[model samples]
Target chain A: MSHPGADRVRDVARLAGRSARSKRRSFLAEGPQAVREALRRHRSGTPTVEQVFATDEALARHPELAEPTDGVTLRRVTADVLAAMSDTVTPQGVVAVCRMLDVGLDDVLAGSPRLIAVLCQVRDPGNAGTVLRAADSAGADAVILTHGSVDLYNPKAVRSTVGSLFHLPVVLGVPFADLAVRLREAGVAVLAADGHGDADLDALQDASAARRLAGSAPDDEGTGPRLEAPTAWLFGNEAHGLAEEELTAADARVRVPVYGAAESLNVGTAATVCLYASARAQRR
Target chain B: MSHPGADRVRDVARLAGRSARSKRRSFLAEGPQAVREALRRHRSGTPTVEQVFATDEALARHPELAEPTDGVTLRRVTADVLAAMSDTVTPQGVVAVCRMLDVGLDDVLAGSPRLIAVLCQVRDPGNAGTVLRAADSAGADAVILTHGSVDLYNPKAVRSTVGSLFHLPVVLGVPFADLAVRLREAGVAVLAADGHGDADLDALQDASAARRLAGSAPDDEGTGPRLEAPTAWLFGNEAHGLAEEELTAADARVRVPVYGAAESLNVGTAATVCLYASARAQRR
Candidate 1:
């Protein structure tokens, strides 16, 4: 059915805000990439997507969605209604109402994850999403958003992930201290990614490579933990980095070396480089 | 001189758009970071910053600008006037009008540059700014924007650079074909960063490292050109990557290997990784 300017449609649009999204226990997956991922996850029994709302043109573009599914309710929306339901200046023709994707912290940790990205108090929606995407690309097993992070389900953050939210486990609203303990209990080394950290990232890579060449055992140089160790990377806010307590709490603090004159690397790009370095080391 | 909603302020606000900025030969450097960078360049004789408009509160925050400068004109404005002249949702209370910062291609290429970033048809302001910041951090000598890329002077693009624009020479509006010829003649290897390229980034790194280990020479294993050579990374647009001709014209197309299911790296992040790899190789 086509809902043109209905209250129900407007209510869905209001989910873009935090309180409304919390009350509704749902979030929007805007654009083709997000909607496709939501649908794919739902069909595979994850049950993220509850409904798909699209303009006729959007549906025509995504012909594969025409095949009927058991759980998802597909609806046709008028262009006006689609506009009303959009959070962006130019709404993509498709939007999916997906259930909250964040899993329990305990559940995520229980899965024996080798790599996890912990975002602590990260404020930028775009940066948060980019980290999630980077973590997924680096084969991170899970992502955790501690208290004070931008809402995991924020439309912009969701869009930024490019559907990585659906690909991996994301645990939300966990206390950083508690999460760190759990990671330790699981034999994962918690590494704080900070600019001030004494352990250089290149040195970490070299140490891991040396260990591999020396027959799979980390040496005793005290250059911080080996990348081959099961690890959780804790990243902090944009302006103010991780609190001193947060840094102290980690098994070690590792810094991505800046080879050029730029003072510091962006949080998103730094997270990507660190994650990839770890992935490369662990895979070897 | 509080020009709350004056015609002059309105005209200045209009400079946020491309046509108006091009016509006026001035663009906005908004917020403390961007405005500071522009003024720094101006005092160093680069003459990019022409005027500064600020609220009393903004001027108080920046004590360095309290004293009058030789060239920059400072005007006090009401908060409302500052808001009128601002583009962001939250005005940082300061804005500067900067002259065109782009240099001629011939001028940039004449500097005997070792590393450069060439953007081809890149459209997103955030991505473009990010690439600028990344290139700067990687210690690139210059950045060239080929025709069809987003406006370098666009306010959003400038904001995204986080003041990196001031730190490096940026050349704009050069035709791609002419740029390729100039780069080749300059002994600068042009490498197209593509996902389907024959040369893998890891393989390239290994080859460069191997050559260095074997004593100061590039190996001829046919993987691709050595990164230590003067290199210009040509990054394509977000939506459509480099065209076949563009990719074919490069010395070789080098792909950043993806370890996870992420279809590709973001254009900005990909450019950062490529530039840093080259920077690291050259540094070695």
Candidate 2:
């Protein structure tokens, strides 16, 4: 192990921005959580990790981070080198450079996923990352970010996800129609999470429960699909909600009913609720 | 209406920092969402607003921004002055200076609350504000932040709340023990949202429904009060969860089961799921 040369440090720091990461075809995963997950994925034949830089203390603390195979490299550096390559105000002593992990819409669809999050034009990096984390927690098969959405590899977005990005398949740069048609053809009903939708989330949950209890499947009119059925949730941007064309493409537009004085929950929190609801219903 | 003097601009900008805000006894609520909510609260006589600064364009677009009552001043400023007074990179053409709105825990308890969110040592302004917005959306009567939590009036926290801060009572700086006792005296059952808790949220929801079907109140062994019962949800910090002592004080410690590869949802998203579960159960 040796201290990173000045040129190497400068090159790594360029990854703190989107353009460099895009051009290099790699991103930096900072801190222990993200680096740990990236290494895990890299070890599991993903080839996502390019190189890992850690201080002696950090390497001693997380020895598992040193485990890499087949072209993966680990280097020890002073704390200053780690900080220079990190985007956060405080560096966590470990940073992993990784190739992008996003797959194509076809790859995601080929899996016949049960639950997917289709984020359309979501601009906030933190929100996008939070939704990815929520989708992973809810056992979603994949997350598809339509065009105009925030860059999934943006440093802020990567950090916000903690490690969930490495835990799930994320599809980037897909068009709205491609996602809609592919999901529908896969028999995954697309539902729009609209604030002003006609369908109520609670009533849908109750109906699905009743159907399950009766030992039958949902065959109701105007209810679209039962909660237990394969589903794709379409979430829009933070400010202007789902476009009229986007909602029109959905099987049903459903709103998470607001019980209090708050106008509406933010996009990330709202998606979390919807994903959790679907997870609970499918389990039942 | 007139331009804000240079000194006034400097004073308002100082509110962006914690020490200055503490000294001035006021905070800046930047952007249209926050300013609108502050004005709404002011109009209702809660009188949280101190003064509002807006550009003529902003005023024309949102005529309601000019409707403050007696003793409230509306100043028209250049976009430059507005940006100077705002904490955001791009000022939204409006900013509201307001007194802190957090109330005493005793006041929140006196409201005979059915649902409440108790945040324990939660840091991260974005997470705190999202929890506030979630609690408000779930129709919680109030929110309580224990000692060691992030300041509720931190500019980042206020902006993340997206106007939900004015929708309900938020109690800050309460000791854990004091909050525990007051909630008990108010007949509210405290449930700790612990990741490793014994109780499962889905099972609890089903058991509550089962008890409802039995046509009797909650009296089951091991399962504490039904979720429909008046309750408070205790959430811990982002990195370290609730302390052992805090968990012991709760009636039941419940975990939101993770069905996917994600280890756990972030605290903010987890809180949203818990709050929505309670809101749905109460409605049923």
Candidate 3:
């Protein structure tokens, strides 16, 4: 059955994306686990969830949704309304909209971070999410998305993160020019992964033996050996790879060694390897 | 601009999936690279491609579609008709219905082989495709997908392979019961990846001593570092991972060591690491 405010529901759904354009709000907070995490970390110690739409089936499945809250708003919507609002194929039966958290560069880099991931022009939403999830697991401090990268709020991208989007701090919309300046200013060395590089990953790991790299760092760079500083890795687009301009801006160019048949690796897989390698180096 | 035979075109498009159920004739070929790869391989003596379809635009873009050959039926469809028949959001203007080639266990092991990948219950079409692509790049001799894995002819899976599916031999629908017997007969040992294993990946690689230990003969059944024969590396499902029964069946259970916070590597990333490690060992 159609609802009374079908147009309103559709409008809210569209608002998920256009919020950035229309209201200057660019992020979306979604999924049950994500919603819970968002609630747990509210500044007021009580998250003011702007809206809540739940189904009888969903509420029964997750009774926690029925819990009373002081500042949170509550409402009931048909499955169709929730479906219309959902970006994923199967809506997890819960979603929330809030102002995007503006995590400052200084705050994200407060300490001498051992690991950081810099994403350059990664176009696939799923790849972007997986990269973030990997970085979260590796205990990396932040993920930097440069120009031409897919938006992190793209629903498929958010779902792929499996709640990691909330756990970690992500900085997006930074141009390559700004990233080079900002990261360099923060003592972050940029290492871009290219297929043709002089140094092998194994030797590079040995070079950065003092730092305790964990979670994800930047992609490995340099001609001789491992990354030796507080590094930020640069990953490029799947098809075009790292642009020459971006590659030239990097402190080093590194590659994962391969043998025999394959010419290259998938962008996501390559990023994961480099991040994990840096983590291993730091641990040593 | 509706064509007279538009109904038939839509009917054919819908049948792509259902056709496999009845006729067991499923074909998923798209993009310029995929269609071109099919044409090149079929012309070079592989008898897989049964027919080719193109629009006038596609024919102009890829003149190779005009090549004459017996048993290769070339059909012309309108651009709209081609769009109706396409599975991708952006059709390459050319597609082909290729006969599925099931390279058998004996066929893949015909020569003294070095590297191979065996996927068990890997459900994601994209992950399966990447594994096949990685296998091809790593120069693996063959890729085998056990029952319960994603269908090899899935359109999403085919697209993710990026034409690498044509370069390497892939075998699907093999039951573990049959695979166990065939692997034993071929003098191949199976090593399954586990998250919580006794030793780390580096230790396992070091123990293999650069694959020099993977000599001509299989080790004694169920004893000491297990069989070092030409190996069959098994990858499990994305969520629950390898079942206890499946993990126990392997010649050895191995894990990729993690630092910091990642719960585990994404399924495709893990498969690539394990496959590349084995390939590296074989080379040594």
Candidate 4:
């Protein structure tokens, strides 16, 4: 489509937000990283892309973007069409419609599945994205988004992931009860990171050490049977942390202690700290 | 001052980026939190706020924002004026021109000055703001933004801070040479955090154990002069870490060990881990 008409453009713009995204059951992916990930997945015969739209200038800007791929058709559209489809400034000049990467619990738990981050009602797109990026970088098995979490495909959330979205399994819209039962059945230790956590993360480190001691021969620092069993570190919303029940359900409560007068750390920063703490301890 | 004309709006928008921010010696502070911080400081005899501009709707929406203050004056302008002035969606309906907080070395070291974060050339506004939030929460005495870092007052940077900008002194634009000399004079230990850091952060943690042990002897951390000291943790640009000279100038090099595919953590996340590690070690 060279250019959608005014009404169609309105529809495309609406697609950039939640309502249209839900209606279409697809979201727009823009930017070099996002588009490149989409194209690569399509070429690898994963999900066939619904549409590939690029401006002539985009094609010129990125000659490689014009490559041929089966089942993935490409078209040159007007800048207006590109603008209609974008929510970020400096659109990567290419856009694509992607069916959500909605993996099921079985698929998520099929692997060794050591580490996972379960985000609860994280409303900010930036925070949710950062958590996913942390999960991806930490080699977590997957990121499960429960009720009230921001939509992962929100353009801002996608931008914040910095392309890690493609590298990891991010399943959204899962409810708390379903996650609790699902992860429990898969032998995952669900831990919650809260300010009032029962134990500081230091204790978690100590617990990992104690587990190692119990599992291995006395001579080693004890590196056998990692204490975490397909772990899920649940982080709550920025303003209010995880609900009391969620905290109680955790195998343990972990906290990143603060020393300053500042009331609290940002949710994204805290989530990164907690994820890194667990990941580091597992390494030890 | 409703609708200061397209020319002025263009000028303000241009200044939101770096070159103009420097040339004009002013930066943008958008959203309720940042604007509220500016307003609070203005009321507290801080003399930093230069002007307050709000739309009629904003004034109506937030009447408490009109509390009379000595140093700052508030201006009620048309919706067009606030819309023209805002960089965020929905505007939070207020904008302020505040003098940058000019924190001198004397002011930074005025108190106990136990910990500090020195960021060099980190260009992302989100990263910079997150670091500020981390530093504030960790009870660090101050944050030093070396040359090439993002303008701390950029609207996005301010938003990321989530109001921590008001809690601590942030010194920006300081040359590296001056920072090194000043820190050395204050008997501070400068630690550089880089990908190639010589010692793992655990070593830094261990270094504090003796302080804590000796601290039990009374006279506050055993006259080792407040475990962390005038200690400054140096961080580098996102794309490029600390320069060879900057890293070498540090008293020690430390790294946060990672167990996953992430070659390195995000700069803000790394800085938070480092600062929090320092915070953990200094506690009683």
Candidate 5:
């Protein structure tokens, strides 16, 4: 791929836009980290990467990326060509065209997911990705972005995930009405992470810890929802937070305590706390 | 103020640059939320904001901003002029010229702070601001940026803080060498948030909780550092993480457990969990 303006390069670059990505059922993952992760997923039998384009310099620097994988086409391209095919100003001389990896909500539910993160109307791609990465770190079973949430395949989001997108199952465009009912049927408690919620997260964690320390079952004492139970946390839009309907749909609205003068926690920071709290409780 | 090309407008816009900000000892806080917080700080006797420039629509939309305040110059500017005087493409019709709020490390240590977040060699502006905001959410007493860290007063960083910059004390440009000795002298344990640390954050929290539930002293059982103790958490660079010197300087290196396939947690996320764990334990 010598020409920066070639039709193939243009086609790969088109994945930067939503309509193009939707039509092709694929998105571009730029930089060595994302491309490396994509190839790893492909090697793991996920069929994630259709094609990987890299400059010689990149392949030289990351020799592991040069190893060929089945059904994944690796092409050497000029740095200019790679640049032309990437969304970021510096794509680190590598890009991968990968299949859209979001799985069905039913498939995720069938896995008996112990910890799930459902993003409700989270409009920022970076925030969505941050939450997704945090969820992966917390060992979440899955992440669901409800209808009206930012597109998980947005390049900035894919970049922000820092390869976590390839690490877990993501379900996109889920309807809140259906999701709440389905989650309850799956025996998962839907908890809304609200700023003004009556239930406090720290208190819940404390109760869970006390029970565990006393050799009692996680749910032996608390009438409220237990952090140790199968749970799905709903994080809302960065600006407006969880809507009234969404709040009411949850089993409980839980607020992360703010001991400082901050008006509220950023959605990503709050999600990390909520998800990690559940992860710790459930693991214990 | 009506002229977009006015020298005063240019001077205000120049604050987006570090040299200008350093020379003037001020920075620009754009959008309503930051301006509101700056005004609130000023009203509360901090004298943070010097001038607030807003459009008629912004003033009308936020009538509370129109309230009279001592020593604050409120000027109505044309939208074009406001844009010219702002860093963001859309400043949301308002911007404030605020004093540089970072304090000396000696003054911060003098307060005998319980929880602090120290950023060492973190270069990304957004990451710096995100950590600052997370520290605020976790109710940390102060945030310290080491010598090589990003400028917290960068326009994007200021915007990323979302008014939290005005909420707490920040110490900037402190040498790690001096900071470590001062923190030790102040009786604050310096814990490095390292990915490969021997001490697990969750385990520390569990021990803290067990002690609390058992009505025992926080430091009774463990040879390890207690999360309930007055502490300073050292967060490192996004790319290379904490240097060997930084890791060795800490009394203990603590790692936030990554329960899943995520190679590591983002520094901001790690900082949030560490700080909140300390806050919860100390408060208990």
Candidate 6:
């Protein structure tokens, strides 16, 4: 791995593109954080990392990354070689070739997921990854990217996740038509996060809190959807938001109220609020 | 405005740099959304926008932008000219020269603000703008950037704010030393958003909610800082987080709980959760 222009370097770099990643069923996870997470997943019996390339300096800085893992090959490379194999200008002297980790929607449903985040037509890779990371922080059981959403394996998206991409199950390219029906069948209420929705998120949280304070069951009082129930939150594109069809498919459309003059929340910010609200309610 | 290399075009383009922006006391606001918001702010008597450069297509697409303002000079320019005057590769057909909108800290404190977000040593432009926008969405009264924080007027930051920059009052370059004292004197509790903080944000919210449900005053039972109290939330840098001094200066250090495997939340996401929590509790 001494030569920057080596065939192996070119092969790893090729994973930066979609066609190559699709053909190989693997993607490059650059930097120590991503590679470290990949090796951890591999050690946990997920077969996540096939190979890890790192410079001596990086390994020295993050010594835990040097730990041996079964079936994971670790190679020492020059910084130039690591950079040549990465999409970012600075790959932080390490890169990992990992298997595509998206699970099937059916597999996720079988787990009886308490909280799920479904991205619909979210075109920006960074936004998709940010929402996914937020979902993980909120203790979401899974995240699903519907058809037409940005590729989760895109290097920028993976980088934006800051290692959380490997922390939870992700289902990619799930069709909205089937997703809505299947989630409902799994007893998970599909709630569309819309700017102009009838149900206000704060109000719903208050209702849930009041119920908890009164020691009442979820179905004791309110006709509105309960925040404590098993639910799937659908977030839309950064620009136009959820389409009419998608909005209509949900059990109820929920809005994160804008108390200021801001016309709307960025999809990532809105999703964080929505997911954290659910996490708090369900945990209580 | 037809020539891309004209002196006027160069003058507008110079705003992309900090020296030129500071010299002129103005910054570039690219894209239609920013320009539209600048015009609105100008029309509302703030004199936010000095001049707007737009292509024929942009003016035609957003007719309201073509409306005459008292001091705003709307000049129709060629697409090439607009691009030459913008920081972005694609200026989206319009750009505006907006006055620096940051107000003095004393003026902001004079208003007895409720919820505020203070950025300490946050270096990334996008993160700064995203947090400001989140603060606005959460109905925060003002946002303060400490001495080491990123420039709020950076073009990417302004664009990232999506016009929310004009929606709220922002205090820039305020040193944490004086900021803490002034805010406390103004009757606002200063809460630092720390990952390892002793106070949990969710628990604070729960306490506030319980007090409300029991028809009690904010200071009735809990010794903790209530989310309903007028407070300033301190968010640290994207990388190393708050300095030890900033953390210790706060009346209470609050942590946004991470329920899952995510080591921590992105600063922007954490800020949103904290600000919105305060907004919800205060409103109730």
Among the numbered candidates, top DockQ falls to 6
DockQ, per model, reads 0.56, 0.76, 0.35, 0.36, 0.89, 0.90
lDDT of each: 0.84, 0.87, 0.70, 0.74, 0.92, 0.91
Error of 2 at B178 (Å): 3.2
lDDT at A47, model 4: 77
Candidate 2 deviant stretches above 4 angstroms: A68-70, A217-223, B211-222
lDDT of 6 by residue, B57-143 (tens): 998899998898998888888988888888999888989888998899989999989999999999999999889999999999999
Clash count (model 5, backbone only): 0
Q: lDDT of model 6 at residue A281?
A: 97
lDDT of 1 by residue, B104-154 (tens): 877877888899999999999999998888898888999998888999888
> Interface RMSD (C-alpha) of each candidate?
1.9, 1.3, 5.2, 3.4, 0.7, 0.6
Q: Model 3, range A188-230, lDDT digits (tens) per residue?
A: 7778888876666645653343222232343443344345457
Q: Ten residues in a row with the worst lDDT in model 2 chain A?
A: A214-223
Stretches of candidate 3 off by over 4 Å are A1-12, A20-26, A36-52, A63-77, A198-229, A257-263, B1-15, B18-26, B59-76, B202-229, B258-264
TM-score, chain B, each candidate: 0.95, 0.95, 0.85, 0.84, 0.98, 0.98
* Runs with alpha carbons beyond 4 Å of true place in candidate 4: A1-28, A35-87, A93-99, A110-112, A196-198, A202-230, A239-255, B1-32, B35-87, B93-97, B109-112, B196-198, B202-230, B251-253
**Model 6: reference contacts kept, as a fraction:** 0.90
Give the C-alpha lDDT of model 4: 0.74
> Candidate 6, residue A124: CA error in Å?
0.3
Better of 1 and 3 by DockQ: 1
- Model 1 chain B: ten consecutive residues of lowest lDDT: B214-223
What would the per-residue lDDT of candidate 6 be over residues A179-278, giving only the tens digit for each residue? 8899999999999999999999999999898898888877767687899999999999999999998998999999999999898999999999999999
Ranking by lDDT: 5, 6, 2, 1, 4, 3
